[model samples]
Target: MSDIIRRDPRAEWIARNRLHPLHAAMQPVQHSWMGPNGVIRKNVHGVGFIGPNGIKRIDRSGAQQGGAAKRTAAVEVQLPLHQVAAPAFYINVVPDMVGGRLSSHDRDLLGLARQLAGSDGAVLAVVFGEHKENAFATAGVDRLLVLDGHEFDGYSPEQRVQGLRAVDNQFNPRHWLLPDSRSGGGELGRRFAASLKERPATRVWQIKGDECIGRAGAGQEDLARPLPRLILAAVECADPVSETRHEVLPLELSTALARSLPRIEDLGAVAVDPAAIPMAEAEFIFSGGNGVKDWALFHQTAASLGATEGASRVAVDDGFMARDRQVGASGTWVTARVYVAVGISGAIQHLQGIGACDKVVAINLDPGCDMIKRADLSVIGESAAILQALIVAVEAYRNGAKRDAA
Candidate 1:
C-alpha cells in the first residue's frame, strides 16, 4: 500500500500556502504619439501580451484611454506632526490685477504662498474669492477648499474677515498667514486674530511646526524667548526697538533701531545679517523704474557709474529686466547706503522694499510722483537727460578722487 500512504504535513502546507498572483496578467495598453523623424509618430504606448498559441489575433478593445501610464494609486506625502493637526492656512486671495493692472502685489503674494505653504510644513491652503481657486492650484495640494462669496468680490474688509472667520470656524484651523502690505491685509489679520483669539503670523517667511518664527519680537529680553506669534506686518528686520508697538514701522525706522540697540545673543528675533540684506554697504546705487523709458540708457548710466542696476516691478513685469533685480513688494528687500530712484513712482509697495536706504535721490519729470516726496533729494527732469548728466558727474568725481589720492 505504498508504504502505508504516509502523508507529509510540510508538503501539504506548501501546496496550501501557494499564492495566486494578485494582479491581472495582461494590463490594457494604449497607443501614444511620439516625436521622431522630425514629425510626430503614432505607436503602441505600453507593454501587453500575445496569446499562448502565439499566432491568434484578438480584439484590442481592452486598452484604457489616456496614453500609456495607467492611473494606479493616489499620491500622498506624510507631513510633520504639527502640520497634520495644525489648522490649515487660508491665503486671502488677492486680485490678479489692481490699480489698473499696474500692481503685481497680488501675483507676488500668490508666489510667496506657493513657496511658504509647503516649505515649512504640509499646511493646506484655503483660497477665497469669486473664482475661489488656488492661485497655486498646480502645486499638487491635497485638498483645496474654495469659499466663494459675493462679499469677497466687493472688496469689503469686514465681509472678507467674516467669511474667513466662518471658514476657520468650520475647519478650526490653528494658524493663519498673510502678507505684509498696506492693502487692509494687516487690519484684517489683526481683527481676525482678535475675534478668534487664535495666533496670527503675518508677513511670515517661514512656519516651523506649530511655532512661527520672525524678526518681530517684544522688547523685553525674557519675553523674547517664548517668541509670541504676532503680525510681522512689515518687512523682516533683526533689531531691538525702544518700544514694541504692533503698528507697522517703516523700514528706515527699523534700521535706525538696529543701529541704536546693541546686538544681544539669543535675542529670539531673527537678526538681519548684513550679508543677507542687499546693498547695505553700497557707496552708490543706480535705481531704475517704469519711468525710465530707455533701457539702453539705463544700462549705460549704471555702467558709467560702476553702480548696480535696480528696477521696479513695473519695469520687471513689462519685460525690461529680471524679477530678482526688481525692487518692490515681490522683489528683494534692500537697505542700501545710497539709493537713486529713476522714474519710479514710489508706490507704498515699492517703498516698503527700499525704505531703509540712508540717502534717496529721485529723478523724474513728474514733480507730483510720490517718489519725489520720499526722496531726500529730488531732481525734476527727464530720466534720460538727468541720467546721462549724472553719469558724467560721477565719472568726473571718481577721476578727481584718484588724482587727489595720487
Candidate 2:
C-alpha cells in the first residue's frame, strides 16, 4: 500500500487506516484533489492550453503599459462643439420626376435635411409641382417653395438649372442638397454646380454627425467633410423616426422668376422602351453577365420575377445588351433592394455599382467566383437551368398566394 502511494502522505495514512473494516466502511468516497491552501486549483494557462503548472504570466514593458493608459485617457476626452459646422441655410431641390407625390427617395432627402438642420438652421425644399401643404408638412421641412405651371411638368436640363439658379439667388443658400437619382436630379445637380462654380460631390451615401462622407469622382477613396457650397446626395432609404419637425411655410412662386426663364423648344415626348425599367427606380434587378447563354430566357425570368433587366459591361460591349442597360462603374450605379446576378462574374466595377444593394443572389457555374463569395445566397449550377427552376418556383408561389387570397 505504501509503495502504491509514494507522493501523498495523507493517501498513505488513509490506506493504512483502511486495513480495518470499520475504518474503510466509515471513510467517504472522495474523487476531487484539493490543495493544502483549502482551494481547488483550476487548469488555466496563458497559452489557452493547460500545462503541468497552473497559469503562465505574460510580462509587459512599462512603456507599453503607459501607452495603453494614454489611449484610454484620450478616448475619454470630449470633442469640441466648434468642430462641426452648422450651415445657415440648407436648400433641397426636389426632382420633377416624382410629380406631386413624394417618393421614398424624396422622403430620405427630407430626413437628411432634418438631420443637417439640427437646432440652428432651416431646411427649405424647392418642389416642382403643386402638392397638398399637409403632404409637405409631414416631411419635416421648414418651408415649401412650389414651382407650379404646365411648363414645369416635363424635365429639361437647361430649364431646371435656370430654375435652381433663380432659387439660389433668392435664398442665397450656403449648402445645396440635390437628389442624385436618374430622374434628372443628377444632371440638374451637375449643371447647377457648374453654374455656381462649385465642385459637387455626387452619390453621397453616409452622413456621420455633421460630416458628410461619400465617394468622390471616379476613384474609390471615401471623402469626408462638412457640408460644402454644393452637395449632391443619392437617397438610399427613408427614415420614419426623424427628430426634427416644423410647420411647413408654403411660399408662392415669383412671377418674375418664372418669366425670366429661357424658352426651349419642347421636343415632343420621345418613345420609351416598354420592356425596360429604369435602373434607379427598380427595387429588384436581374442582371446577366457573359456566362448567360439565353438572353430570351433571361428577359422571361425578369418578367416573371417583376424585376428590371440589367447587364454587365461585357454583355453590353458584345452587343448582347443595350448600352443603357449596362450596370458598372463606367455605366449606371444601381441601389436595388434585391439584385440577382445570373451567370455574372462579379467584376470590381460591377461590384462598385451594386454596393448599396441590400441583398445579392448569385447563380454561377464556378463556386469560387467573386459574385458567389459576395452574394448572400449562391446557387452553384448552370445559369439557364437555375433561372428556369427559379421562374417555375416563383410562378407556383404566386398561384398559391392568389388561391389563398380568394
Q: Lowest summed-lDDT stretch of 10 residues in model 1?
A: 248-257
Query: Over 4 Å off in model 1, which ranges?
Result: 1-284
The sequence of per-residue lDDT tens digits that candidate 2 reaches over residues 30-143 is 223222112232222112333222333332322224342242244332212211134466556464335355654666677666666655676788877566435555566676
* Model 1 Cα lDDT, one tens digit per residue, 129-169: 53422223332232344445444453555565565666555
Clashing pairs in 2: none
Number of backbone clashes in candidate 2:
0
Best by TM-score: 2
* Predictions in order: lDDT: 0.50, 0.66
Assess every candidate by TM-score: 0.34, 0.46
Residue 394 error for model 1, in Å? 1.7
Counting clashing residue pairs in each candidate, in order, gives 2, 0
Query: For residue 323, what is the lDDT in candidate 1?
Result: 68
